[model samples]
Target: MPDLSLLDIVNLCDNCRVHQPDPVPSPYDSERLVPFYLSESPDSPVIGLLRPVIVEQLKLENQRSRDSGQRELWALNVDESNFVSRRNRPSGPSVSFRDWLDTHTKRTVAMKELCERWRDTLLFEDVCGPKKWREELYPVYADPFGVHDHPNTAAPGQATNFVFEMERSACALFGVVTYGVHMTIYDEVEVDGEKTLRVWVPTRALSKPTFPGMLDNTVAGGIGSGMSVFETLVKECMEEASIPEHVVRKYTRASGAVSYFYRTSKGWLQPEVEYVYELAIPAGVDPQLFEPRPSDGEVESFELLTHTETIRKMRQGLFKPNCALVLLNLYIRLGYVTPDDEPDYMKILTRLHGTFDFERW
Candidate 1:
């Protein structure tokens, strides 16, 4: 929220106490020229952090004036364009997105190599001493989601935690994506016999565009953490699924199973925050009433599935990998199915693509 930029850091470094300016005779030959030096407000927070070396740098700049025979030889000028993004018209990083992506690609490749080396070191260390291996090599190989072991031996717990925390912070920008599940119960005339609970999925649940040009092939994606969980949920619901603004507000309830995720994508491992909610449908409201609105034309078809049929569909990989798992868990947790009823979670297992795996903490 602060208006500070990188220039503020650079300028702070440039101006030092040793750089006081010296007076010179005016060219007009009447009055002596008063040497000017860079100055800033005393109340600025940045002023306190200035090290002695920075002050010395500033002093050198000030002395340069008299040597160059100029009064305003070393002046601090705040760059106006330092903060703005060229493509997006926002003020942030100096590097362009293309450049940033390229750098990320290189980093990802390097990290992959580093992870491999760490893995090899760990394997070698494991043969020597188990205790030494855990202490020395595990910390370095650990992943953010705790998938890998920490390879650093110095301080195993602290070092791994530090790395995981750092990795989580680095990739937090991509945000979260989640799916909502709903079921409509249709009853027959009989009180005990033939009733059906039909599961309905929104055509467009949550998604971000991977390619603007190939909207038709675009997958459902959501930007998480940019807004609060509920805010993001509502926004994504509207964007991908075409949940009517009023309808979403009306049926949405806080079902309270918030889960935390640390996701790696595009070479950054971001923190993903998400929660689930279930809203009761009014008696008159039909599940068929809602139509799927594809975000990037990713919707194949929308159909209602019964409990047994849903499980069968899961086995056939009708949904996204993680999405299928999430749906299966939701169904089991919500009592739509029994825990003993193990649906084919394998259907949800798909190779993760387009996401960068973080090896470095």
Candidate 2:
């Protein structure tokens, strides 16, 4: 059953206001889908490592949505700062970063490990020690495209944007940043003589630390050190979905990216970029027929859902943060949601890209 009943109202941000739609009986009706609430984070005081311009750029995106004059966009505007995360964040741990990052002083176990490890490796220095550090047990995240670069690093401070530890990246220490890929998979469906889309949604294994047991894109993995974008996509596809090399190479197509500075539970910053892809699972065949289990333990299972149901669950805050952003990108690019459908269409486009200055990187 769709969660549309409860999802009828949403927020662009906590402070943004809401206008409810006329209640409709049939959940699938597109007319009723319009005028729903959207949760978009608004700008406040400067925080983390982002510059005022970059931060304002993000707020402008939300401002467009808020400023939309009674457009029939999905999701209505709402008020107050409480319940902010509920608008977009997939259900997870309690309100941690959205509230405590400003007040909390202690780091979580994983974050402490990252901090200690970074202190040992001279993360702030430009010495050759970084190379030797990579040989150790630490993670090395390389941002070749500099997609995670930000403008807050001070003059003459070009972003090294290379070799980050897994724990550190998770902790967002010293304004450290990283990149990854999120591929959304879908199959074409002909429902009642009309063409529609059904997405392949993956459930993350409950053992994972972040957003465990939450819904995710079909295959999403960090673009680890030394791998190109396509390389990471193919590797993740095989591991997470049991997709073959041939299928990945032929079926996976780049679908741009969704970039944001996500605030995680442990108070670590995530100035991250998720290079998005759309993998079209051939209509007649899926990985299940050929592979009985996932090559990796990250994913628990895969389920195909209609686009309506997918969005409905997403509004219910069931999708992982990055996963939800990736899905929104797909919705925008596929014409399922349009300028008419979204009041802040252009802002949404700009904000989703989360463009960073490559020249400084």
Candidate 3:
């Protein structure tokens, strides 16, 4: 409900500047500053956690992509000039028609209809009509701009939650995208009288509808319709980690964010932005000693792993895809992983943060 969005996370970084032992240099030109640094290179691997076939779909919005300081967005297999092809512009005044209704437009026909509607519907060929789509998928489409206060959620001035569905959110078609927040609860550990690092990782509940028995961040949750980014972060910390409000308010730092356009194994177009955070536990509390009693049933258990162990699990693909990217980003910022360590470090960083149209938080 508040004006806060992931965009505000960029401002949180200003407070962190003085505390950073080795701060990344800020360029004289405002365009080059890193709220989260990213290169506007299409050839750069921006979409992590997706298969190569789906990743190749990332095409330049314009030949001048490298020239645009914002690198505003990355299109998937569509011409840049065309409005329908834009990745995150769902509310634009446009519509593509279809004889069959996989999902009907309740209030606005233009919004319910999409550019890649037919292409998206083909994957669900066995299913039919908007009513059927709702019956089957039961997607809780989210309003990216946080329209929670709007009295009539079903037909608010903005598009309803349906816009976030993969097919409905198709870049070259629907153009809407979703957002969330991810936080890594970390602390400095003393092993063998030497200083090291340890991170708290959560194993998702096996009963979870998606990615059961997988790994996740210390605390993570989606930024749903009408909820502000900070609100979601605080709420998730309490629910997921049982982290107290005082601790979260004092130690948590809004590090940065990552965005990506992914094609799920289930065949949906998922474009999302994840605002990242770092919460350092007090010296009196040991990460391993604390029990993460998940208030929500989403997490099965919690394990504290050292940096080496974390990377090993990452290589094995134990963590959920996006969570893995978030960890990799944390490692890079911590200087645990560097450009020299990987051949495509620069590209990895660019794609890891993603290309977003949103201005700096």
- Model 1 weakest lDDT span, ten residues long: 352-361
Reference-based TM-score of each model: 0.37, 0.56, 0.56
Per-candidate count of clashing residue pairs (backbone under 3 Å): 28, 13, 11
TM-score of 3: 0.56
Q: 241-287 in candidate 2: lDDT tens per residue?
A: 88788877887789777775443343223556778888776656755
Candidate 2, poorest ten consecutive residues by summed lDDT: 9-18
Candidate 2 displacement at residue 154 in angstroms = 28
> Of the pair 1 and 2, which is ahead by TM-score?
2
Query: Candidate 1: where is the Cα deviation over 4 Å?
Result: 1-192, 202-221, 258-273, 286-289, 295-298, 340-361
Model 2: CA > 4 A from native: 1-171, 283-293, 356-361
Query: Each model's RMSD to truth, in Å?
Result: 24.6, 16.4, 14.3
lDDT of each: 0.32, 0.51, 0.52
- Residues 1-361, candidate 1, lDDT per residue (tens digit)? 2332222211211111111221122122231111111122121111011122233433564576568884432233224454332222223221111122122234334434333443455532322223322111111111222222222333533443112111111122212112122222222122258554455543432331221221110112332212234555566556655666676677666643322222222211122212455444556777443544545344534554555565554454344333443444445556554534434322212111111111100
Write one digit per residue (lDDT tens) for candidate 3, span 1-361: 2332212222212111111221224321122111110112222211112222233323332233456653323333223365332233231212221223223232133323321353355633332223323221112233343433322346546544343223323322222345678998877777899777788899999876457898899999876544667888888888888887767777789998877644344333355678999877767765443445677788988888998788777666576777877887898898777767766577567666654333221
lDDT of 1: 0.32
* lDDT ranking from best candidate downward: 3, 2, 1
